[model samples]
Target: MYLQHFALTQLPFSLTPNTAFYVGLAPHQQAFEVLQTALAAGEGFIKISGEVGTGKTLLCRKLLHTAPAHWRLAYLPDPALSPMELRWALAAELGLQYSGNIDQQQLHQLLQRHLLLLAARELQVILVIDEAQALPDETLEALRLLTNLETEQRKLLQVVLFAQPELDLRLAKHQFRQLRQRISFSYRLRPMTVAEVAAYVQTRLSIAGNPQLRFSPFALNRLASGSRGIPRLVNVLAHKAMMLAYGRGQQQISWWHVRAAAKDTEDVQAEPAFIWLSAALMVVVIFGMLFWQWGPL
Candidate 1:
């Protein structure tokens, strides 16, 4: 509804993990580089871990989108499969045709033969699993066994796991030692910084065709602080702030709009009773800083 008011052609802050709106912030960029390098080096297993809403899914999609031509990618967005189901899913992703009543051993043979065929054709097969933290223990072990399907030169299937931080805790157990050992490279995504959050908002706005629609310094600072520099929270606050501005028929987002948005959002970590008073004080402080930074904004 606010798209026309904000001169935006698309929703800039939608929660979906769309690669077109991906921001190459420091953490995401470094993680991408690490994944590319590790995959290029023919590592059998790699992992990218982040807190929820830290863009792991977005980065995973970006990696899949830019994967090398020699690599065939199989994506598993849900990891709640049993060992047998996991095998079937992998077989399906690899386009292996098999009977519905196929036994586990038969399914495994079919998958291994398909992988061998791909390897013979000089193509590397990659399985990228998202939400890997939810994978059952036996399923994870099955994945490790998949990596063991290698020739003398290179692995038949490389796996890149994109999961939340809980995946690391799961891997710390003695039961997962073999799977953990196979992870040749790993990257942890960090939350964005305050400045990075500001730039992120601007970048998305530019992508949505409205670079001129600006968030005031005070509002942006409140957004950055309340969101704790997390991209998803920032998006939520920004979208709500813009809606407030649209309601008031205002062109630029202000501190009051951000304060109201933060007060309404459960993720903003604001004390319910102190929102208005804190906003008043923060406005004074923010204006003072703004004046000092820009010589009377």
Candidate 2:
């Protein structure tokens, strides 16, 4: 609704993880480098863990797009499958079609054959699993076994797990010792800093074809504090603040817009100290304007 008012071609703060709007924040960039280096080394298991809204999916998409030509990527966005289901999913990714009446043993044989064929062709098959915390214990073991199809040089199937921190806790258990031992590279994603948050907002706006609309320093501070530098919350608050500014016919976003936005967002925590200080400053400004105009208390 504010596209024309703000001179933007697209909405900048959408929650969907779009690579076009990606800003290589320090943590994401570091994670990207680690993934690339690990994959190049033919690591059997690699893990990337972060909190809920720290841009894991975006980084996954970035890796997919930038992977080398010889790389074959199979992405599993949902991981709540049983062991048999996991095999079937991997088989489908490998383009191995069979009758529904085939038994689990037969399916596994076919899948292994296909992976061997791909390895012969010099194709590096990478299975990237998002939301990996939901993977069951049996399914995790099945995935590990698939990586056991290696020749003397490198693994036939490599796995990159993009998950929340809960996945780390799961892997720390005794049942997951094998999978943990196979992990050659792991990274923990960090939240953005205040400066990174500001840069993130501007980057999105610029991608959406920003012309003149801008956020005030007060608004940026409130957003960074309220969102705690989380990218998803920053996007939610920023979108709401832009809507408020447009509704008020204002050219710039101020602390009032951000304050109202934070109150509306469920996950955002209000920062009361700065809120009271801003209120006091507003009152002093109002009093000064009144005294200059009509003289008096």
Candidate 3:
């Protein structure tokens, strides 16, 4: 709604993971490089994890889009499936067909044959699973077993898991030691820094065809602080700030607009009211303690 009003071509802060609007800030760039290098080396299992709003899904989509022709990629965005369901999903992704009445043993054999077929054709198959933290222990073990499907040289099936930090905690347990050991490479996507947040916002704005719409330095600082350097939160704050600016027929986004946006957003950016309230509570407690230690005059 604010696009035309702001003279922009597209909504710069849309939640959809559009690769074209991808900003190569340090963390995202490092994650992409790691993905490319590890996948090229045919690592059996690679992992990328981050906090909830730190852009793991965006990185996953970028990997899928940029993977080399030799890579036959299978994407599983939902990882809640049981081992049997996971097998069926994998089969469907790989375009393998079998009778509905097929037993687990037969299905496993069929899947193994298909993997070998891909290997014979010189294609490297990679299974990219997002939200991997939700994958059950049995399904995770099943994935490890799938990686065992290898030629003498390299694994026929590689897996790249994009998940939240909880996945790392799960992998650290003794039961998952084997699966954790097989992860040849792992990258943690960090949140954007204040400076990077400034660049990131400008980058997205430029990509959306409006580089001239200025966010005041004060506003940017407010955004960086409010978002705590998280990209998704930054997007939400920025979009709301812009809409606020547009509502008042303003061209430049100022700290006022950002503060207002933060106030409206749900725990995204810190609100001045909340900060002041906390400060007041702290002062009251300190005074109360002083009165208890030394009687008021």
- After superposing candidate 3 on the true structure, give the runs of residues whose Cα lies further than 4 Å from its correct spot: 269-297
Query: Residue by residue across 1-297, what tens digits does model 1's lDDT show?
Result: 999998999999999989999999899999999999998899999999998889999999999898778989899999899999999888888888899998999888889899999999999899999999999988899889988999999999999999999999999999999888999999999988878988999999999999998999888888888888888889999999999999999999998999999989986767345767897999999999999999965
The per-prediction CA RMSD against the true structure, in angstroms, equals 5.3, 3.1, 6.5
Flag clash pairs in model 1: none
TM-score, every prediction: 0.91, 0.92, 0.91
Q: Scored by CA lDDT, what does every candidate get?
A: 0.91, 0.91, 0.91
Clash totals in order: 0, 0, 0
In model 1, the Cα lDDT at residue 112 comes to: 88
TM-score for candidate 3: 0.91
Off by over 4 Å in 1: 271-297
lDDT tens digits, residue span 239-262, model 2 = 999999999998798989999999
Give the candidate number with the greatest TM-score: 2
What TM-score does candidate 1 reach?
0.91
